[model samples]
Target: MNDFSKTDRLMERGSAFLGSRYAILCGAMSWVSERHLVSAISNAGGFGVIACGAMTPEQLETEIAATQELTDKPFGVNLITMHPQLFDLIEVCDKAGVSHVVLAGGIPPKGSVEAIKGGQNPAKVICFAPTLALAKKLLRSGADALVIEGMEAGGHIGPVSTSVLAQEMLPELSQDHIIFVAGGIGRGNAMAGYLEMGAAGVQLGTRFACAKESIAHENFKKAFFRANARDAVASVQVDARLPVIPVRALKNKGTEEFTQKQREVAGVLDRNEIAMEEAQLQIEHYWAGALRRAVIDGDVENGSLMAGQSVGMVKEEEPAADIIAKLMTQSEDALTRR
Candidate 1:
């Protein structure tokens, strides 16, 4: 059994892994993890990762430089490996001197990993894996660390739940590699709990989405505040197939619309009516524009208001700095009490 009660041991190891005051990482959220939020979290003592979902190389370079100007604190940029501009995004990170680069979405290509870890680009590469096998593969492929994100995470979740993944992957992975756990992590106690469970750090997205400094639309924040655990459920029954990307969100019009669209797309396969390429393109297009409608335009009803189950615990919109401070303080308090 691991001796989790050693505070010094935990802090030293945690800091080495997370490079932050608290072992908490703000998950890279597309459209939401822009300059303000990223800088705010990093300045507040937690690792903030900027999400680079659909940005061109030039855009990513501009964003990385902008984030650096905001704070000298260490921060990271997230890239979806499947994105068409994956190589370009990696080059941007290399040029911008980004301390860390988080690769999310799909299996990272070998060339992409080599580019990130190759000489001259010392940026720590982090990848999200749902299983021990995948984690091992990523580690072997030059990933500096792994983010074991569970199914409870919002926005493109893996097939496995966090509870199961943590239990299964943490023990098998070598201690040399870092492990950050994600999915439904909200409070400081939650962070401490995961650390006790062998997680080097915890990644939080939904909680930060409700922060005052977050760019999410007011209506979107309100929806999170209104949601309870019961209100936050995955859409499994709607699609029970493997490789099902679990999405934990509040039951709303936008979610219903997405489900309906998925069903409609699935039904038209027999007649060769909807090409897989076209269907995927439409879904991607729908989400690409949908989040902006809710986040920027404040149109919650017909927009994608992606949030995790932890949203129920978020009551008010507080400053990002305050949120970070409170979480660290709370985690310390919880650890001391234990």
Candidate 2:
């Protein structure tokens, strides 16, 4: 085995926390992060997370089972906080003996953390904190670890940049908590920098979106391959009342369509046809469908092509093991150079 002693030592706490050889995490990309890709990442020694996006409890249960069959290495499940069946999904993960549960999309509802902890398998809870205050609050509220993502991330995102968030939150929270830095990270040099700044580890989505095992459609992978950092853009919220969360994706007809979608959903809100919570859920639901169109059907023009700024760095398809090895080797080299 290649000795990455320096880098491994830096990632010791994170690797121990994740029960993996490396502290790297392949961020959950809906439709893309399923049994094949998730298992491949775990098998490659980096942590992988199943994006349980809009899947029914039964679907999630099946997915968990399928992933387990492929690899015995540890993996995580990402559950959207706003899913009406959030608790039920938690039950599914708990029953399947999932090692970790990532509560994303928003703040986890009351008792959600407790429920995950109280389950038969007692999975660790991970939450996303957009700011320093929320990071501390989530840790205090039983979140075993935290992911602080920036606006550069694909799909749903917060307003801050990753560098800014890392600078502000790492010093204050990393000493007392397991904080994983994410968003716009495309290389191991960047990962090394974050580890040096006290991050427990790092998470990356765009870097692995087109891994050889990824199920994203050929056109979708092509879109990522052709995209430059500037080609990936964030959507604009059309109506203030709708409060639709901003989404980052490759610029395409679908990007413009999302603005129209917000207008249509906002109109429904104006007519008292749907409540605010439901309105937000509708927006979330739209993304799931749109993302599927691109990822599964290869409709790059009208389908959402969610991509982080690091899309520019993803030049070709490679096996998950190779991707992880290259990242680890680069990290080791960077650390050695230091």
Candidate 3:
């Protein structure tokens, strides 16, 4: 049951909505937020989302069963829309009795929503809405909630920052839908600020990536602890013709190679050496499996170290419960101070 320690009405509602002791959400990280991390967060009284990135149906089922064995609390699963086995993944979640399913990466397929909300299993659908138009469309498409993540976040990001989107979307959308603000959130004060502004809750990935429960390699945690906000830079599109998705990450030799790779691809495109689709694929393939190398294999030098601008705020490795308690206390204090 909710302790109701938070005086803020919005925070209470957020906690109630998620059925968690706290309003905080541990945003799923590709290889990092697996069974161990996900269960720890849930058991600590915060909502945890398992990152189903690139996991097949059978694999996802196994992971879900593993997480269930660890924690009896509510948790969710994050699935990329572009997965080849999208429908199969949904079926796995349904049969696993998953309570929540988050669809990310891109716009979902037509019947995907209906399929998720189908049958005896009751899984709430949460989707990323990049624009107001898309947000309305998703709500109409039966998405139970929306998460607006900005450019400051780690991994693939949009062009806008979190603050601006909160200003632009929260006032109109929050009342009608369960809107969660994400990206660049490192502390409870920032979360409190957003909650006051009408965000139902806040989702954080960068800070949680360093939690003691996290399976991310020690090298990955070290890089996060050592880096500042400025060190985390977003990937840019060197060629306007070749559209490459922007990704925020810590600077390293691999990051520099991305620039060179883009330049080479742009040159090839200009000379008609490759088609537009092929050139885009080349740019995208540069970081394929890079996160796994860093998060799982401890290859910080050459692998992808996806971190938000708030990486500077992450100090040391702490238990998942400690992180949740600190953030909750900070939020309560901020509200009282206001």
Model 3, range 1-338, lDDT digits (tens) per residue?
32335534777777777888766788888899999999999999889999988777999999999999999999999987867688999999999999889999889998898899984697889999888889999999999889999999998899999999999999999887789999999988898889888888889999999999999999999999999999999987887887878889999977877888889989998999988866765554566577888899999988899999999999899999888878877887888777
Evaluation by lDDT, superior candidate among 1 and 3: 3
Shift of residue 325 alpha carbon in model 1, Å:
1.8
Model 3 score (lDDT): 0.87
Order the candidate numbers by lDDT, best to worst.
Answer: 2, 3, 1
State which candidate, 2 or 3, has the greater TM-score: 2
| CA lDDT scores, all candidates in order | 0.78, 0.94, 0.87
**Candidate 2 lDDT, tens digit per residue, 37-78?**
999999999999999999999999999999999999999999
Residue 22 of model 3: what lDDT?
Answer: 69
Cα error, candidate 3, residue 37 (Å): 0.7
Backbone clash pairs for candidate 3 read none
TM-score of 3: 0.92
Query: What are the runs in model 2 whose C-alpha is more than 4 Å off?
Result: none
Candidate achieving the largest TM-score: 2
Best by lDDT: 2
